[model samples]
Target: MTGSGTPPTTIPGSDARSNGLPEAAPNPGQRVLVAGGGGYIGCILTRCLLDRGYRVRVLDRLYWGEEVLGHVIDEIELVQADVRDFPGSALEDVDAVINLSGLSNDPTAEYSPEANWQMNAVATENMADACVARGIDRFVFASSCSLYDGLPAGMHDEPPQSSRAAPTPPPSTTASSTCSRWRAIPSARCRCATAPCTAGRRACATTSW
Candidate 1:
């Protein structure tokens, strides 16, 4: 069982030939670019990725303080940039992209709906497009459980209907959009996994072409 306490379950549709997420271990030294690496989830993921022997680069606007990433500062490269304006040059040579950029939590989204849509929705699609354009095959989108809101306790295990996509809440339009983009990519392999939610835990879906 993972730290989440739920016995681990294989996320539907995961394929090792695609994004490499399901691989027992990713090859050492493969470079992965993490957008929004300054945030809480990103900070934790960055360290873990490093420990697994992958090279990491972070692109963030630093909406939060940088102190969380300080411990790994020298080990990884940091690019101060927003997901909306991320440069293609940065994607050069990157083997994969992990997108964590977005308006986190309901309060922040409520405070600025337009900004939330732009950052969470618009920018997420942009990242997928950019990755495709640059020939980056792997993408992992860190999405929130806000999508699962109102789901009945037992219904959480229910499969998506017809659409073949995960059921998401209205608040997570961004995640839905990102999943749409992955679906549009015919060569991409996609998987939706429900991670155990802790006090502030986040979950992600992985895709690859």
Candidate 2:
């Protein structure tokens, strides 16, 4: 308390600063977290980020061949941790996050539905919450399109994108579609690169979700 009766505060660096919450902005160049940086597309993204001079930190279980990023190992920081158990410290001082971890697709998913849900669905939701708590900026996500399953026999194939050439949903039955059809492959892994919550950090996503 102040001598007169008011609470007292001081500067941070120069002998006295208020709690020091905003003394200066953080330097953003240090590092970025690529959650699934070892996956197919993630490998490319990791290289691109490294080429630009940002410190790259890759968090992956190496579910696939680790060689995917062999060419650039020296230039990146690798973390072998599953997103489901992602350490809170992993989000610290991170400029961005590109989430590419998840159960891949149908065949693999059927192998173990419980595992898929635990690794893909649950982990993603938690990661979103963690990022919010951290102050990290930006996320690029890649999600599977399986969630859009239509009623049994109630839905038809989506129309092509090239034919429409406009912002309109294709008619219920367009013979051919400009848009490419998505297929579920055997691999079952989380591909949610960037989720909606990341957008608050001006995140960029590559997934369909």
Candidate 3:
């Protein structure tokens, strides 16, 4: 085992007495933090994650509802907190973050687009940044299709030549531009899934979840 020649061999599944391949240990919580866990979707998500053996934490303003989470209060970590003031320390060991706190496409954005932008767009962008900075790469954003203002002008049934509007792959960068670049955190594994409609989750729960 000379340094210049080859490193010492490591036995599979052995301790220091032989070679230091570690013994199997239970998963390290595989922690997940749901940003709005008191809401309808958040509560259900927490339970679903918990049932799958992932450790879960709930950080919510709880302005809408908390009763949905009452039964599982004992099994989870609850923080009545806002995304703007998310405590960075708690995220240190977390594996993923699913942010659901935002003003849904409600009429209130008209009163103050500034506030809405701050919470919905800016805060979410910053949340991604924070997660990357802290090595939590997996981030799932609860955004809406409302942002997709433009679509392919031609229906799928129509031939390409019949299309009135030109389509050129839409710049080949929508997802990366909006989300994937932030997943570069080397230590943190990442995924950004736009949660489907509320019904999607419910349906998943019925069959696969």
Candidate 4:
């Protein structure tokens, strides 16, 4: 991972000023807590935030390795821990949280569906509750387009009408349900990025709920 001193124009779908939060003004002084910031996508995102002048703290299990963030290791605060049992102190000074802390693909989920459900669904709800209790309003969840897997071809672009209509795999479905349930929290500004990412191309649809 590489670190830069420039900040990005904005965080996707965040409106810090709207909910009585601090004015972003490009967020130079804001600190973002990125859960799972050592993974493939998370590493890239962590570097981007650092580039944009935001202070970043990464909470990750680092099940793979930390070499992915070697280049910028000195620039971030790294916490080696699982999200499921993360301490409340992780949210203490955090202004916003971007959760990318679950199993990334089908094979991993299939290997242990129990683990998948706990990480993708239950852990997410627990974190969101913690954020709310701490008065942290901004939460960005990295969801998957796989939630639309069983939809008819024509309906792929549309949000699933109901859980029954989607019939996605257990992991993806439960993750999606977690996103929906948190959308109703008045103080939480929940944004879901449904990504259909590939080695050659990455496409994401960001929706605020």
Among these predicted structures, which one has the highest lDDT? 4
For 49-125, candidate 2 gives per-residue lDDT tens digits of 67656688899888876788798888888888887788887876776666667665545655876666666666655
lDDT of 2 at 196: 24
Least well predicted 10-residue stretch by lDDT in candidate 1? 197-206
In model 4, residue pairs whose N, Cα or C atoms come closer than 3 Å (at least 3 residues apart or on different chains), thus clashing, are 6-51, 6-52, 7-52
- The residue pairs that clash in candidate 3, if any, are none
Please give the distance, in angstroms, between residue 39's alpha carbon in candidate 1 and its true position after superposition.
0.8
User: Could you tell me which 10 consecutive residues in candidate 2 have the lowest summed lDDT?
Assistant: 174-183
TM-score, predicted candidate 2 vs. hidden true structure: 0.56
TM-score of each: 0.71, 0.56, 0.62, 0.71
Q: What is the lDDT of residue 98 in candidate 3?
A: 83
Tens-digit lDDT track for model 3 on 1-209? 34667888765423422322123313446888888788767888788778767788888888866777897889998888776677776576688888777665435554766666666676677777787777675687765332332435433221112222323221112322456555554554555555644212322222221
In angstroms, the error of model 2 at 77 is 0.6
Whole-model Cα lDDT of every candidate shown, in order: 0.66, 0.54, 0.60, 0.69
Cα displacement (Å) at residue 156, model 4: 4.0
Candidates sorted by lDDT, descending order?
A: 4, 1, 3, 2
Q: Order of all candidates by TM-score, from best down to worst?
A: 4, 1, 3, 2
- Clashing pairs counted in every model: 1, 30, 0, 3
